[model samples]
Target: MTAAHCTFFGESNPETVQSMQGCMRKLKLMVPKLRVQKRVKELEFIQHVIEYIRDLELILSEDESYTPHSTQISPISPHLDSTYRP
Candidate 1:
């Protein structure tokens, strides 16, 4: 979980950070739906998995904040915002 050598997220940028925030908001909104699972064991596992993913996200964010990403690769096009869908 070193800040300078993140292996999971690869890189960060304005668009990528924005998208991740948006997706996280959407996932939180879906938590209630997860509570309706008929099997308790399955529900617990699903919740654990989601928590694990969120933990990774936290690590990624912290890494980006504490390290320099100026040399990292970014796929976002500065010219595509006007036509981009997501």
Candidate 2:
């Protein structure tokens, strides 16, 4: 069956069944890469949380080894704004 939805450059150029199958195949191949990227982001977030907890533990223990850098800023935090000063 022809793909009625597949078109190019505002043209109604009908895609053959082969072309549609190829598109699906390409999308399937890309799925792994997308999944890997998502997993990496998840791992990074977990690691960040672990490190934060470790820092908090050190501070609570009064080890003086967990000094938070004043210049450090969280790029992932949405709570920060242009007018907001710490």
Question: Which candidate should be chosen as best, given TM-score against the real structure?
Answer: 1
TM-score between model 1 and native:
0.30
Q: How do the residues 12-80 of candidate 1 rate in per-residue lDDT, one tens digit apiece? A: 877766666565444444444333444445456556447645754555566655455467765634433
lDDT string for model 2 (24-82, tens) is 45433333333224334545544544554554454436745434554655342332222
Judge candidate 1 against the unseen true structure and give its global Cα lDDT, from 0 to 1.
0.48
Task: Note the residue pairs that clash in candidate 1.
Answer: none
Q: Relative to the true structure, how large is the alpha-carbon lDDT of every model?
A: 0.48, 0.42
Lowest summed lDDT across 10 adjacent residues in model 2 is found at 77-86
Candidate 2 global TM-score: 0.27
Clashing pairs in model 2? none
Give the C-alpha miss distance for residue 5 in model 2, angstroms.
42
